[model samples]
Target: MRTQSVLVYDGDCAFCTTCVNFAERRLRPRCESTPWQFADLAALGVTQQRAEYEVLWVTPAGRVHGGAQGVAKLLLSAGKGWAVLGALLTVPPVRWVARGVYRLVADHRDRMPGGTPACALPAHLRPSAESPATAD
Candidate 1:
């Protein structure tokens, strides 16, 4: 069994929506995902700005994980070969690189799979891609 978590993502982005659908079919984590625009952010301790900028995992216990870490937790909870990849991504050097890559892809996501020019979050909503600190 899996503990419930809310996987908050950008519903308006086609790339993000397709990625969520991919996870739904492949990872099959127990979490229920929603666009932050519709989910109750206050109840989850997630800021709308943050949700707009990155993936968020909020557990029933109120534990919050954001960005790549959030994706990692979701994969591990899914219980499959995917967990191994998720675990590896959490290791030190790989974790560092993974976060960087995640940010890079996020910044260029309008060019990613299923992405469209209009799939991007507004400029104000996008964190400074140069500063990892800002994304957190």
Candidate 2:
């Protein structure tokens, strides 16, 4: 967060883009969504590798939340319903489950709707997981 809150994601992944579309249309948070590639990563204190691994929620306070927490934080910026949902998801057992589920979806995003084999992370960035990593 550099005075402005933002949802940082991968620009090269279609699956990621699809999710972002849903967030924009449905959640309609006050925050802005930007591809990490187009954002000032150094300024945001976001590493390229971290951005490749998970969605990030950067707050004006410079607090960074990753994965399920990040999603929840982004939703928290939306209206009442979304804020409630976000709060619920960020709590105890729900947060634990959300993390696992997020990992599952992220790990197999190439098989998800709007996903493609090309959605996989680049070689160098992927040090594991079938000689490469899953989608962004």
Best by lDDT: 2
Tens digit of per-residue lDDT, candidate 1, span 29-97: 888999886898988887888888899989889888888888888888888798988898799998998
- List model 2 lDDT by residue over 1-136, tens digit each: 2556899987777899999999999889878799987888887778988998999998877778999999998888886889998998899999999999999998888899998786775734433334324446
What is the C-alpha RMSD, rounded to one decimal, of candidate 1?
A: 7.5
- The residue ranges of model 2 lying beyond 4 angstroms of the native Cα positions read 123-136
Location of the lowest summed lDDT over 10 successive residues in candidate 2: 123-132
Candidate 1 lDDT at 8 equals 92
lDDT of candidate 1 at residue 99, scale 0 to 100: 95
lDDT of model 2 at position 118? 67
Cα RMSDs, all models: 7.5, 5.6
Q: List the residue pairs that clash in candidate 1.
A: none
Residue 62 CA error for candidate 1 (Å)? 1.0
